[model samples]
Target: MLLQRRALLGATAVLAAPSLARAQAPSWAARYPELVFAIIPSENASGVTERYGPFVNYLSRRLGTRVTLRIANDYAAVIEGQRAGNIHIASYGPSSFARALMTGAQITAFAIETNLDGTKGYYSVFYVKADSPYQRVEGLRGKNLGLVDPNSTSGNNVPRFALNKMGINPEQFFGRVVYTGSHENAVIALGQGTVDMAANWWNDEQESNLLRMERKGMVRAADFRIIFKSDQIVNSPVAYLNTLPDELKAAIRTAVLEVHRADEAAFNRIYEGKQGPLEAVDNAAYEPIIELNRFVDNLRRRG
Candidate 1:
């Protein structure tokens, strides 16, 4: 009888363990039950899914909830998704994130990407065909320019800011301008000679949209030459809607900052270990981008 009682008691405790864990889940998690995480469209949707699959799975496990993955077709969609509270979490370029706030999207930036050297910035670069006679931005005047997306930071915003500083209005300078809709598409347009020049993001010689495309054999790095490189812009950031419960927000931020520590291989796959892990960040870090956006807005007004 004594042995049977002891065995029963042990079984009860074992069964209760799961209950305790469930109780620790965020108060709001009960209401949400599932969360939607959206990723900015830096690349194709299929590739985005393959790259983010493990990371999203890790987030689900860490948060003790079902986290669904959604790849945004454009930065505007991500911003709109968050604004409408349809997306619980989403990543954005610095300028895109800034645009969200400027346009009243009630979101908070929680984590920022970093360079391999631990710098929290990247650059906007102009790409032209290597054999093209044009060697400078001036030479490309009256030529078609490919901007990634209207909301893209390094893609359109920073590149335009750089041009405005050069006393050239993109609308009046370029024979024509087209938004290729993505970094990959910008290069695609350039490679196909659809556009004489394209603006894209570059972190370093080891990592860039060009290198990513090269790996897929879509374009040869040697075939393109970077004609202009803008000053380092703030790295992209992951953000959450402000409407979420504080506890949920904290958990999401903690989970993001510890992603590399929790699953180094998954995190490494995202950046190929060429970049550092995500770091804690907030709205203040993006003020410069907000200012930049404002400046760009003023330019539009002047134009």
Candidate 2:
């Protein structure tokens, strides 16, 4: 009876071992040990740091979690970090968000940068030197057009989509196409006449870059023309890895939307204008972008 009882106890111990290990297993919070959010810097690192450091620290305090801000040198690195699960949350351009979702990241919230006629959406504007004689989209024919990046929604995808609507094949439409890697670089290329035209995301005509160029006398409202514009896309999204726990995910979603109300000034700088409060959203909201991508892909296939 003693031996039989011993065997039964041993079996029970073995049965309980897996549960014990699971109970002791590190949680998402434990494994990460902290929360990190990444932002892609269009400006120089120093400018970004000076502009956003205080805001980052404030978010850390509010969330009651250790928070670190990561400034990616370029857009791809930002998305790649999120895809690998090293970055917990990110502010992603619509195109970047699309790419992240394709690779399995989940979008939880999006910012509304402006109130255009009481609606929140932004568009990509195609810019050319103000002095250029090109008056319309068709004028871009046989002229070099600068594209910011292959993955850029405003810089690449929107222009291509706009071109398609104009019945022009983007690849064959421009005399030459160059990718400048960022919207800032694209603007520079256009200002310096390195390319005949470039695309960028903007809401207000009074944006800093537009004002700067006008002040420099390099380009003016009359100097450049928006050859094409695309439908309003929901602004950049704050995305998370699918691997994150639902509870933690819910918390992040709540914080992003509520943080604006908690600290308005910091939120304004981080968003780069009147990019006001965030709204709860999910990946499905970007179905239009996905469809646009597919249309572009199909055109490539047919061509």
Q: Which candidate's lDDT is highest?
A: 1
lDDT of 2 by residue, 26-132 (tens): 45545555677776655445555656666666656554556677777666777667766777877777776776666555444444334434455778888878678
Q: Which stretches of candidate 2 lie over 4 Å from their true place?
A: 1-29, 106-118, 206-223
lDDT tens digits, residue span 1-303, model 1: 000100000000000111226756667866877788887788877777778877887787777777778877677878777877888998899998998888788999999999889899999999999999988899877899999987899999999899999998999999999999889999999999999999999999999989988987888999999999999998999999999989889988998899999999779868877899899899999999999988988888898
Error of 2 at 149 (Å): 1.4
Q: TM-score for all predictions?
A: 0.91, 0.79
TM-score of 1: 0.91
Model 2, 282: alpha-carbon shift in Å? 1.4
